[model samples]
Target: MLDVLVIGGGPAGSTAATLLARKGFSVRLLERDKFPRFQIGESLLPYNNDLFDRLGVSDELKRGEYFPKYGAHFVTGDGRTEFTFRFDRILPPEHQRSFQVRRSEFDHLLLRNAAASGVDVREETPVTSVRLENESCFVRVASGEEIEARFVIDGSGHASLLGSRTGKKSDIASLKKIAVFAHYRGVEKPKGRDAGNTTIVVIRDGWFWLIPVTGELMSVGLVVDRDHFVNCGLSAEELLERSIAATPFVAERMKSAGRVTQVYSRKDFSYRVRDLVGKRFALIGDAAGFLDPIFSTGVYMAMKSADIAADAVEARLRKGSMRGLERYERDMTRALGRYFHFISNFYRREFLEVFLQPSNRFGLLHAIVRILAGNVFGAAGDRLKLALFFVLVRIQKRRPVIARPIRWEALPRAASL
Candidate 1:
């Protein structure tokens, strides 16, 4: 019998397995795919610097070939007005920047790091089923072998190992959306120092994310409501092209760019699993829940939750109770709720009106920067400031407190890069 069995080999699984093994627990991690696999979510938050430092991979990242992202650039869909939320505004100089990584290499590095930490890592081994029976879990692999473990941690990204087996998911009605994306070569980027900043263009129906993953490559994606796509009657690739052509801001950057990979689409991307903890099981990462990537919170939240899960699993195995697991559920719930609320309001014009115009009168911009940097668990005073900011957005909706942003003309005129 194993002390703990972790499903999937993404950041959540690798981080949890590594942490548990360091505690002297017999841990095994199963990943369905091989290393260096292509994955999305290339934009990372500055908060990740803290996690990597603790995970013992900070030095490796410095030695690796990755781009440092100092801040996020927000642009109007028409490319008229914009703002850049510099991470240094809130974080210290040493921790003010994160990175834009090719998920393929970054995830592989983390998985290998886990193996170095004494974790029994297995790649290309997919899990078939996970059964929770009393104080232990029975995990069956695709090869017909069954292993019993004292506890199970589900980090299977969107596959949701335990979630699918237990029917613990609910659709996010207001956020029924789809994402169409691919890699490109020679996309226009900002000048030096600003080149690494992730550019986000907010459109009428959705938004566009342009991430400089490497010196020669950029990951561009279009996110919009599902109905909007269906009504257009275009394939994934066509949808991406039409979206780019419609948005002059994005079209301008891609003028010199060429597609390097086939387009891929993901739909119904928003959902929540309330029952994240069980008697002897727990869900981490995307297996727990997923909102949106507006604030680039996916990877940070995954690893952070895995870090928290490792401690809760350790306590559960030692104390012989579910209290630790329950606490994990509550903490993750609160954290996810904060992001959800912000994302839910992000699509509204009122939110953009207020967000485009930053203010520090009552430390509201300070509060916004905290959340943008993935620090959702700030003090009560921060929460008050965030609430006041939201109230200001609501007020702006009823009464125009500022000038309305400029819109694009029928034929977008090319803008300087």
Candidate 2:
């Protein structure tokens, strides 16, 4: 039997497979899709830099020519308020910068790194069924090939292979939004260090994300309430265009731009699994949960979870107990909770007031910057930072606001999807 079987070749699966293989465990990773496939979530957080080093891919990534992102820029729909959160100013020097990458190239790089580290990687091998029996997992692939492993990792992303099979997947009602996105050329970009910074344009209905993946290409996406899009009756392309037109900052930047990819849409994207681990299996990455992309935490969280999960799996194999796995689940839950707390309140006026018009009083801005830098876990110092952030939120709620309320508005009659 193989020591481990990973049911995806994305960052999570590849990370876990690489780590386990490096530790001398036999790992086989099956990927449903081949590499170089189109994927979104191009923006990455600084914390990922550490993971890359741990996986020995830092130098490779540096040589890839991906856009170097040093910070993030936020602007309101009216274009009157804006601010840039420079990672260098708030994060530890070593964790001060990350990259915006084309997912195709980035994912392929990680997968290749895993193979180089002794992982048996099979592309275009979809897992058809997963059966857990005590301390062993039997996985059946689409080719009718059966594999038995000591443990299983469901890094199958939104497919949630094990989560769905066990009826553990559930939607997060509060985070009901759909994203429409595509790549474009000729979009206006900032110069100097800000050239790679991800720009967020918050409009009345939703928000737009402008991510620079390369010097000549950028990924532009709009996230809006699912109900609003359904009610608008627009096709994905039309909805994306309408959303772009709604944001002045985004519109001006894309006025002379032309799309280079087909517009795509994903709905019901926010969800969580009831459990992260079972008898001989665990879920990592999108299989565990997913939140709004407003903060660009997907890839970071996935790789982080994989890192933790790998440790837990090693411990479980050595000690022959579920304690380590349980601890991993708890740790992931707390880290994800921190992100969900901030993002769930993103559409609230009180949160926006504090986010758009930040105050340095009580070191709140520094604390927020730390969170934005993906320092959600570890150290008492981080806890203290988060505490200060919550206190500031409570204080902001008490202050009076003259701005308009944050409520969804109906699409204009001329709006087309």
Model 2's number of clashes is 3
Candidate 1 segments exceeding 4 Å error: 402-417
For each candidate in the order shown, give its overall lDDT on alpha carbons. Answer: 0.86, 0.86
lDDT of 1 by residue, 17-108 (tens): 99999899999999999998988899888877888998899887877778888888988788776888888766676658888899999999
Q: Give residue 75's lDDT in candidate 2 (0 to 100).
A: 78
Q: lDDT score, residue 217, model 1?
A: 91
Compared with the true structure, model 1 gives a TM-score of: 0.96
Which pairs clash inside model 1? none
The digit string of per-residue lDDT tens for model 2 on 340-401 reads: 98898787656775677776776767777778878876634767766766666667677645
